[model samples]
Target chain A: MEQHLVDCDLCFDALQVLQQQQYREKYQPLSASMQQYIRNSIKQVSHAHKAERYQRQEQKKESFLIYFWVVAAIAAGAGLIYLIQQQDKFKPSVTKAMASNAEIPAQRVEAPAVQAAVVTPVRAERADTLSHRPAPPAATTTAPVAPPAATPAPATPKPVIKDSVKAKTPAAVPVNKDSAKKQAPPATKPAEVKETVKAPAPEHKDTPTVAKKTEDKPEPKPVPKEKKDDDDDKPKPKPATETAASGTDEFLYKAAMVYHQQGDLNEAISRYKHLSGSSGKYGELSRYQLAVCYRSKGQTGKARRMFKEVVRMNGSMKDKAQAALDNL
Target chain B: MLQQLSNLSDKELISRARKLKDQEAEGVLMERYSHLMVAVCLPYLNNGPATSPEEIYPALLQRLSDSLKTQTIPKANEWIHYTIRAQQARTDKNSPFFPSTESREQQQIEARIEKAATNQKEQQQLIATIERTLDKLSAEEKYLLKEFYMNNKSFAALAETKQISIEKLRQTLQQAKQKMASLLMNETYE
Candidate 1:
């Protein structure tokens, strides 16, 4: 029939007209009532779907909040546990200090005897040196008097004694004595009193052991001043060695960092200053922290100066120091 | 809700209908394609006799409701093909061109050729012959011819329903037309 329509012009024209008429009839829009019915049905379906979607979203939100609260509670519980553990670790040292304080008086009585035993050999050597001199007993008698006088005198003599003793004695003994004097002032004072009996030995015999004993006597007399000088001299090259040996500098540095993190600027500043004065591993870091402390405390001039010094050193703190300087 | 439904596309409305069984989404889908449904019904209704709009409209609606219930309708263009096929099948069953008494073995021979007559008589016979030839086609083939030649639906829509490319749909359409031509010439399509 298609071939027949293509061969015959009249049949082709009739088919085209029929098809066009069919197209026109088919394209006619539906009646208004049918359209209204469809619109109403669509409105119902859309409402149902929307309600279902909204319910699902609400359920999801509720589940998310529940999980968030659960996670937050777990994190808070872990933090509390950690804090408790830290407190337990630190409490024993405080209890030990309190226990030691309670036993101090008993220790004081026995302390003098221990000092006598420790000082006897040095004193006997001094006595032997006095046997060689004519006026050595006079020197021994004057030694106790000299100490009382020196106790009232200025800090200048402490350095002279330290330098002479350090020059004459074995290097290790003076360092040990200096550290001992630094560590326990009360115990060292009685020990120094016993050693004062041996102070005349160095003058008589010129022996290094007696010299060291003589140095130990005057050490407690000008304790505060001698400590300052010893701190200044000991930290220069031996700060790393000393901190490595004892771990006190590292502990103090950690404490300082904790204070800084805790926003205790004043305490952090004090700790950083002490650590900065020492040439330990933390020295450069402490200097940087000290600058940060000063800057936080609103002492911009001191902060800037410290930052400049750190920048000049060009150590680990150089970049931070440069940034701090720029911020200032 | 109606405003929201109005904002959604035809594909979205159908998806909602399928997934959520949303009555409003089905209603929206019906509204979107009702014109095409009415158009496809007109060809079947107007082909033989002058059927009343009242009679045709209810029957069309009934067929659409049945198809929607079955959920067998494809996309808009392909869906129109299904509706046309359904209309043609109903029309043929109600008014068959060939009598059921004619055995398949007897009908296998070519249809009798009529003598050439007056121009009006010849045109009427051509129309009858075309209708007879269309009835010989399977429902699927009738739907393809109606959508392709009559409605001129986009090849893209046909391809999507067929799950093939537009070029493939065009090639298939060409082959279908050749087979249709052979059937019209009283030759076996196979």
Candidate 2:
């Protein structure tokens, strides 16, 4: 129909003009009642539009409030996550301190000694032996003699511990021992230190609270004896050398991590190598991490070698190897 | 007729024709709408009708007036018809003029119109074409068309209410006049 009308624009325009002219001749044929009925409908439609507009405006306001609440909920969730993460970071440190404080309840003889054990490695060995003895020492003496033997690295143990303790001298040993012997229950001393650290039991009213300085200056004895025993077995080897040669990745990895945490990169790197060269899950991780340790210690050459070896070995840890190589 | 349609509401247009003798709005509405309305009607109008317009036009206009009386003319876009026989029945069934027969024929016509625009694209195109051509006017012109064709207002009354001279009102309506001309002409190109 449109195609037929396209013959000429002028012809179409003329036809339109004629149609309009014809239309004007006779347009209105409506009576009065029809006009009134239509007027009422128009009023109804106008009123409906106004009501609809108000409803839509209310919906818009409700949606805006919903949007605001959703954003607030998200912000609250994020803040909660941050708070939890911050608490997690500090939680371990606080627990460690609290653990020391709550150590004594029934007979706290074990706790001060355990705390001293952590602070002074020299006294730790003595505390361990004394903790196992039939009775607690009446005075705190000869505490240093115990740590070297218990640790098996007797010579190195004393000097390092003494250096740490020099800043805070343990009380005179015999005087401390005299107070402790009077205070401690002779029967319960053997049961005090368990293989797994015991929970501090509830306080007993019968127990004496003696604040005799327990971490005594260690007695110097037979340091040369333990070193000589290690030397006699392998004349030139140190106790660390022996442990390193054991190739137990779990133990070595742990020792390396401890050293790493203590900021001893050279020692950590050496221990990490001992573990990395062995086979295990820890061994694979240790090899990758050892390279990182070497890099941290500024031994790039050694780091590159370790990283290359890790990539050459096929395992689930290959991705880790690749990442280390990329770092190199 | 188009000017009257522009002034009158659909209800008034139908109502005015209802009381008339020969039912004049049918020819005037069709003549004014001959180009566009025939296109709308063509799909609903049967080719079989030679003398059918006699029964058909009056019946269709009367039905349209009946639909207006019942406020159903707005949906005439959906209720297009081929023969006035169904409309005659529709009018008779609810007629102040004459009682009608039950219309199976109107249902059939409605079904056929539905079938003609089966493909979604075709249906969409039909609706789109109608909307675009009708929407060529500004909001005011569209409102005027709604008043005149659908509401049945008079030109003299509209001119008086708008507080304008008839000549000024005609001039103001020229934009819509030109658009309707182009729509009738089918020349939107330039």
Alpha carbon lDDT of each predicted model: 0.55, 0.46
**Chain A TM-score by candidate, in order:** 0.36, 0.30
> Residue B102 deviation, candidate 1, in Å?
30
DockQ-derived CAPRI band for the predicted complex in model 2: incorrect
Question: Model 2: per-residue lDDT, tens digit, A68-148?
Answer: 999999999999999999787556434432432342231245434544554244345434344324223411233454554
RMSD in angstroms, all models? 24.2, 21.9
Write model 1 residue lDDT over B25-142, tens digit each, in one string: 6776667665555554554555555455556655655555555555533344445444555565655442212222222222232232333334677667766876777788777777
Least accurate 10 contiguous residues by lDDT in model 2 chain A: A202-211
lDDT of 2: 0.46
Candidate 1: Cα lDDT at B169:
61
On lDDT, the leading prediction is 1
